[model samples]
Target: METATPFKLLLVDDDPQILLGLEKIISSHFSGDEILIFSCKNGLMASQLLASEPINAVITDIKMPLFSGIDLLKFMNEQNLACSSIVLSGYDDFNLVKNAMRLGASDYLLKPVDEGLLINALYELKKQSGQLPSFTRQTYSLTSILKMQQLLEGLIGSSDISLPDADDFEQEHHISGQTSCLMCYVDIRRALYSNYLTMFQFLTDRVESFLNSSREIPLLNPTVVYGRLDTYWIFLLFTDEASFEPEKILEPFLALLTKDHFKYSFTTAWYPYAHIRQADEECRKGFEKYYFDLPYAPSDAPANWQTLSESLDAAAAAAAAYDYASTIKNLELCFAMFNFLSPSISDVRKEMHHFVYSILNRNSAFIPIISTSKFTDYDLFEHIEKSESLSVLKKHLYSSVNYLIGELIESMENKDDYVIQKAKEYIHNNYQDNLTLNDVATHVFLSENYFSTLFSQKTGTTFRNYLRSFRIEKAKELLTTTNLRIYEVAQQTGYNEHSHFVRAFKAITGQSPGDYRQMKK
Candidate 1:
């Protein structure tokens, strides 16, 4: 039978009773494990011992003489020591607790600590440390390991995958005896897909730095793996044991990532202890759910599968039936909702992309058209940088939304339905020449009658009537804004016959062009 490897531990406390108590508790609870309990009356002695010898983890009293736990943490961080740390403290030391956390203590427990809580903390330390052992070993190349570690860290930050399979990983790397937890799935909105690779690489580096400084887990065994699948990125976290709520670990990390780096929000799906073989499929489901279910603004962190599934189903239904006009209205509403959330521009962009893509992907044809357009390729950062004010950003978003909707409509197969667009384009390009509904319909490859019906359906007016209204609106503008004569206005507004223009203008505006101009004057 294979012997269970004993976990190495180091305990530091000024009081003899506390040291003896921890020793007894650890020995009794973890009978098969190796326990190294060091009694130090002060932080100075503990620091000397730490410098001289290797230790897997440390449990220290906060108020030790000459050197405090915070001081020790600073010293360890400066020395770049790789040891998990927990603080043992008395109640009513709120300031100390806060300072210790700032100094990088993984967790703090009050005096007379519950045995279970102590054990759990130790287990968590072991799990975190066990998941990341390469950071400590001498045989691994630091640069290559660092790169891999960075990728794993990004996966942890972006998705809900908890630790990779430590046993299999250890065997491959020739490092033995490690345990890990689950994998996380991270889905960035497809509109942001172009930035996914670079952004993830940057995020991965930051996350690794964070995890490296974390005293709660060991860095020697990286527990996370960041993988890419099409437009989404996946993160797998490996750990010795799964304890504490997984999201509790992930949500704050994502919040920190969004706050510190990108202005975008990230959605994660967590699979605790997911078998390696099933990870890809499980992650796909998670990615689909996240992409489809993201809210208009960041909400409370999601906790379970049921809510995620429900949200996705509702969003999919909305996408399937969404109209461009309705989408514009919703886009404005979503902008308002984002302001209410007070999220950074990146977060807002993430939500916006998810919402837009969910709607756009409803039609398969819409995807290819939008994918090939400049509107879909616009960079949020570039837009934000160029915007003079929030109002400008709002205008930019609205314009892009309108453009995307127009493109989708343009890609439809109904030539008759496109008469209005053809008419508008034609009139825009050839307003100085003779132009009419017949000319526009023929240009758009539509017969007069069918084009009239489709144009009316599209523009809510017959082609001839619509042209008359459009030309008259332009004539009124030129009448007031320019010193052009009535005939010149008619010619500029697409009517060659002056009398016909006057009659048509009067029929629509209930006033001759001269009367309208005088009224404005």
Candidate 2:
């Protein structure tokens, strides 16, 4: 491969992890001789590098502690450095993105950047800087997750994985004569299948992209595989660079993940590389110790966490029973415990999200009502993640729960009203025939007992009384309008016996049919 024309790129961010991540990706793409990359923790340091070094391009963040990315752009503009500038910012910083564009930034990208876009932008910048040669796009493709999973599991069971592709896999992904390896396992507390799928793919892609471009590990492509539920395992075979810190490389990418998906609690443990099986055992042991026996939990942590956990369960139970007040109270208690304990923000969000999941699982009918036609679970989860304090999280939680409960109650009332209206229509049309509470209830698709109680509650009268009153009114109309005899009138009004009909008419109107007909006529 011909050596590409020497190009210089400067990456600027206040975060060291950000700088490290960018450097690794860029270096993986261009050799040290082909593209020289410089990094700094702040805009001031970046400005110093630009002054001393003949930098051809610069990618900078918009916000920093003291001197912002905007200030760095101003310095570049004033100095008239012939450098291609690109700015990065969060979506909230759109105004700053525009300001960067106004200040002669050639392009801008949102934070949690798409690596493909970054690569393309760099390519364009390289072309503009007069690249006269070519570089190799050397990469390792993880063709099958299933195959990789089988190979790793096989390696765990025995000393050597005796698969047909073992030799080719070693040649493609492993460093030759590697004495040591670095292994990292990441676990995210996302319960839903859809959510875990997204998080897993995201972390996998980022690690793969970086490793694919990395030149140090030519012997082995890092092994990236799905571990147990909601976790990922990554193994890198590196040359004897004992000074190399894997945390420095991995932390930045994790930081990027948290920036975008703060609602999820992500835990990672590092292990010394031996063989695949040994490394797996070490990673699991370390992860369990780090996750379950965390130092942040004080001596009183068990009491507090247990209380919060119990409160979450209680809240879910209350919600399932449609006890809105109890559900809200228990939910508030959980948040209060979180406030007192002051657990990690990520853990708090994850637990609260799980509480919501529990409630929905128990009462799935409310799930659609909660998420659809309003602020969805995804939208509310974002709010929970971005909340600055426990109180803010409580506020968002209360809002979502309130909306869900309110809609549920209102829907129940509407359903009752509809059923009653249908029952009334059925009664009015069929009063001349024999009517029963069971018949009306069946017509409206409700149990007979429930319909009977609902009718009384809605109409302020028992079903039998309402039916009798309807029949009497029809009989009165017939006694006055038609010359029907008392017996004929009783038959027309759904009464089989004349004496019974006359007695009911007198009880209701204080007049027998004979006298009432005479008075009306």
Candidate 3:
């Protein structure tokens, strides 16, 4: 079954007793994916949460003081909030249910709601009413999505999908081995899907078709998605077929999906597993990052998306002009600005890729992205997005830029191609830390003088001058994007002497650091 999108669920009732019961039940079930649940003793407060938060469903008692549940229902309709509403009523309140139903309440539950009945009612509402939650750009990993689906299936009032012991959870409850289950994770690109549930139905039906065609008895491998997006699937693999690939289903699905409109493309991973319980611990373990990110609030710093965007555009211009220092500086500024937000590390993946894509996107008329990254199969965006912290993100970002620059320096002589590539990778990675020519020369297993000679011969500059230029460009980025003292910028870019740095800055750019910063400003 497709999981409910993370929603704001409001509980409104005058009686604390009923409010407590409903909270307990729903909290036990249907609350996750960062779902926010709020309870208020009156409609007045519930209405406020509805206004302030992204509420998708509301459960309200029919009669209450000040503002009654009926009044709340009427307000929802008047405002065109169109949220799914379940009315709670007494045995004597069927007359009120008549009014609530007329007012477009989804369904009514009697006082002291039965757990199974409430679940079944909500399930039917999702199916019949077509009131599934909407999508947020937030993307969860495939493992996280599946683990969440398992939790919704297992629990009644729990927020966590993880088990204390995977072995124990599996032992206590396990899928039978007789059923050939295949766990498939599908990544939905932004362009390929619009509504979540419809795409889900399409994939599930496709999987069932394969199962139905199976020569095995009782052969329909029931297919379902675990999350709101058709991102993860648990289905049966057919043994009768010589080979079974979900690609058969996906091929047709892709045919119908417009490729040009695709905002993001995804890879699919399928595995044959005997039982979910067998390796579920690993699945939950992989999802720990998602769980860790639950407490996230967007960075408090005001977003300057336009400024960050413009910097990347400038970096592209610099790259096209062979201003390696300026290109690196501009791109580094983009990463540095990213830190001000202090966003959840997992959330930054998409944003980081966006910036890297901005640079690579310019490769056609400028530096070719393939020649820069293809030799190493460096999926810079993927690596950067998966980083677990700001420090790592910065590290990945610079390494990618350096790799591109190193590749751009592909020599016609070819003698220093390998040596220069290795050297550039080292400098890009270690520039912000402690880096030296000896460190790089040792890394390439060449003597300092020999490596230095080859580098100079290929680039027409001594290694020292090139390294200095690279650091100065990097320092220029920090000068513009950060408020660090000039000395700090110098130190960060592998310069120690303040006077020496000043002279070098003036020598290369014909201006002091302060002057350069003003010019950029």
Q: What is the TM-score of each candidate against the true structure?
A: 0.28, 0.33, 0.28
Candidate 2 vs candidate 3: the TM-score winner is 2
Q: Give the TM-score of candidate 2.
A: 0.33
Candidate 2: tens digits of C-alpha lDDT, residues 119-204: 65677678777774354433333455556556555434354645655455555655344444555555443212222333345456
The sequence of per-residue lDDT tens digits that candidate 1 reaches over residues 396-426 is 5555545555665666676444455546666
Question: Candidate 2's C-alpha lDDT?
Answer: 0.67
Best prediction by TM-score: 2
Residue-wise lDDT of candidate 3 within 1-521, one digit each (tens)? 98756556788988888788877776676656634678899998888777777677788998888889888988888888958888987644768988998998867776546564565455545554455544333344556655655643452113335454433444454433343343333333311222344445544444445444543433244333333323333332322222344445345433333221111122232333344443333332333233232223224333476666677677765554335788777766666565554455555566655555565564453235644454343556556645444544455456666656665655324646656765776776577666777888998899998998988887789887887788888988899999999898888887778888899899889999998998988
Q: For this target, which candidate reaches the highest lDDT against the unseen true structure? A: 2
Q: Which stretches of candidate 3 lie over 4 Å from their true place?
A: 1-415, 518-521
Model 1 residue 219 lDDT score = 36
lDDT of 1 at 361: 68
Model 2 off-target regions past 4 Å? 1-136, 139-162, 167-179, 186-233, 238-278, 281-314, 321-521
Q: Report clashes for each candidate as comma-separated counts.
A: 33, 7, 3
Give the alpha-carbon lDDT of every model.
Answer: 0.58, 0.67, 0.60
- lDDT score, candidate 3: 0.60
- Candidate 1 achieves a global lDDT of 0.58
Candidate 1 residue 246 Cα shift, in angstroms, is: 3.0
